[model samples]
Target: MLLPDLVRTAARRSPHAPAVRDGAATATYAELDALADRCAHALADLGVRPGDRVVLWTSKSIDTVAVMQAVLRLGAAYVPVAPSNPRPRVQCIADGCAARLVLADDDLAGLRTRPGQTLNDAAATPADCAFILYTSGSTGAPKGVSISHRNALSFVCWAAEETGLDASDRLANHAPFNFDLSVFDLYGAFLAGACVDLVPATLAFAPEALTRFLFEREITVWYSVPSALQLMTADGGLLDGDPPPALRVCVFAGEPFPIADVLRLRAAWPAVRLFNWYGPTETNVCTSYEVTAHDLTRTRPLPIGQACSGDQVWLDPPGADVGEIVVDGPTVMLGYWGQPAQDGPYRTGDFGRIGPDGNLEYVGRRDHMVKVRGHRVEPSEIEAVLATHPAVAAAAVVVVGAGLDSRIHAAVVPAGDARPTMLGLKAHCAAHLPTYMVVDAVRLVAELPRTANGKVDRAAVTALWAEAVVRG
Candidate 1:
């Protein structure tokens, strides 16, 4: 089925049901459908024909959601650009997609188009492009991932059924539209005939406020990166207060969740179902692991678990326990937008191993492993050890130089009233890590820099270290 059909089905099944909630405003299924129809007509009037690409440069709101569905309704794909993005980055995405039109907040002014005739739904097939999500390329260029209707449906359909979501459920959308995590938030809710509570970007860093919002909205389902959850639990007093009784399901992805933090969360919310989802933007949630009570005893990172329905995962180099992860399935993207389509399984640069229990264990990225003094070192290995420190809330390890001169630098966020000294952390590492694995420099910050998607901004952290060195 096409992507937009999900919304249409929900509208037909429960037209009066709440479909989306943005702050005090709520849109019913019927109202949302009508808004999407109107937006589609307006875009079509602007010459956005079938198969054309349109850039949605706006913040998270009811209007942005309408634009997304409207793009699909018109048989075209929408490329979402986060409103937080700089003008140059937005311009780069627009130029890359050769977008037919750019839709912004104020740009909708004077856009007066009566609802046009709805296009034949059958005209768009599962193979049609649904959206193009751009990844922050390490090479200073944005790479757009082209996802199709089939690609999205493969994950959405399974998630909706597996999680037992229904019209009574309310899903919390914490990720930005530009991020792939929002796909399941928007489409999965529609598929399940449920409502989605849109969490604005401004509330992302304010953990206390976000927690209050979640409880006030009575959100049933929650999904976001682990960092957000960590902040909520540690600084936001999520556990200090009464548990949110309405929260039933909690899903985390994008990066690894520290094992210690996971145990703490499990202790606090013993009844809530927790899941660790794993995937890249090219493939949305290829694998997931349900956190069991036994998992709390784990001293290492949680396993990524088995492949999701309609997806296939295999490690490169055949029988090796650890190797690059390769994914093949309907959920895999068609390819990078405007580039040649890739055949067969998409080889994710991430490395992982099959545990004895038949679950996948992620070992940092292949490229993230640096050779220091001819000894291979994974930054995650060091970071994991650092997180075990009682005083450290979060930690990241980065390589500072190249070849023999290369050195490991550590950045840490102190937990609660704990003021960890550089000498204290160094001594702690000396007891746990090898001499070579010990960090050469350490810096403490209130919090780590995060990308638009909420992952630790490694590049930004590296640059900050460089700036500190020059100043000293």
Candidate 2:
């Protein structure tokens, strides 16, 4: 079955059930379904057709969700560009995907012109591409990870089943639409005819507001990055008053959760099932580990645990020792956009090893790709953009700190006597990269350190930036 069928079937089951909620606005399943149909007509009226890609460049809202459903119903894939993205970066993605249309506020509101007439569902199949998620590329551009209808359904079905989602449940959508985490938040809720409460962008980082949204909305299942859980509980006092009776399952992914924070959460909500999910965007959550009370005795971070979601996850290069994590299953992405189809096991650049308990544990990355604030960032992508600056002769970027709290620092060599200012380079990056990928701190250097192989030593670049109490 197609991904859109989830909502269609749910609407059949409970037409008047609340499907989506954003602040004071809410859409019933029947309303959402009709809106999607009108949106499809609006899109088709604008020359969108089957197999074309449409870019949705807007903030996370009920309208954006409707547009996604609309795009899928038309047999086209939707590319979600984060609201935090700059104009240049958004255009880069739009151009990269050769998008047939880019929808905005006016476009979303234009759906009203079509009335409430329901359009027939497009003749789409399970193998059809449902969406293309663009992530940071090591080659200086964004890489589009193409996920098919079957690919997404495989994970979404597993998620709903694993969590025992039901029509009475309320799911909180903390992750933005651009991130893969939203797959569960949006589709899983739709599959079960449950209501999904969307957190406003303005209050996403405000601890108090987020915590209040969780309980006030009566959210039963919550899925987000580890940092968000940290901000909400540690600072927002999520567990201070009393555990909300409605909240039963809390899932965290994207980056490793600090053990101290995890232990604290478990201590407060002993009954809540806290899950540590691990996977890159290429694979929609290939593995999951449920946190148990035994994790309290552990000093280090928790293990990523065994594979789930109908994916085959294992370490490569035989069974000698630690190796790169590889994934092969339905959930693995079809391929990167503009590339050939992926026919074999996809090699995940992350390194991993089996623990004494026979669970897959994360090792350090084999490459420089890292997640900052739950968004995947490639240092080379930022460095490439910085190198384009006329004031800089060379550029290098390194991640500082650990896990989700890390900051990106860049060291650049001046072009002759031309000294690049921090603000200048930051402005340059702001124009080219997303807010999360932009370097947090900038430092000037005469030259970058290189090893005997003549490759720039990223570690030394990191050390030079660490030596700076002063910004460039």
Residue-level lDDT tens digits of model 1 in 1-472: 7889988889999999999999999999988888788777778778988899999888888888888888898889999988888889989999999999988877653332455444454268899899999987777899999999999999998888877898899999999998989988998899988999999898987899988987999999999999999988877888887779899999999999888898888878888989999999999999989997888778766899999958999999889867899999999899998889968899999989988788999988987888997888888878888888889999988999888999889889988889888888888888888888888889998889988788998999999899998999
Summarize candidate 2's per-residue lDDT along 1-472 as a digit string, tens digits.
Answer: 8988988998888999999999899999998898888888888999989999999988888888988999999999999987677888889999988999987766678775687786788899888899999887888898899999999999998888988899999999887787788899999999899999998777766789989888888889998876567557646888787887889999988765656667778888888988888888899899999998988787544789988889999888879577889999989998999899888788889878888888888764668778887887777657757866778656778988878779999988776589899889989999988888778888787666753222467778877766664454
State how far residue 5 of model 2 sits from its true place (Å): 0.5
Q: In order, what lDDT does every prediction score?
A: 0.88, 0.83
Model 2: colliding residue pairs: none
- Candidate 1: deviation at residue 158, Å? 1.3
Q: Candidate 1, 108: how far from true, in Å?
A: 3.4
Maximum-lDDT candidate: 1
The 10 consecutive residues of candidate 2 with the worst lDDT sum are 446-455
Model 1 residue 54 CA deviation in Å: 0.5
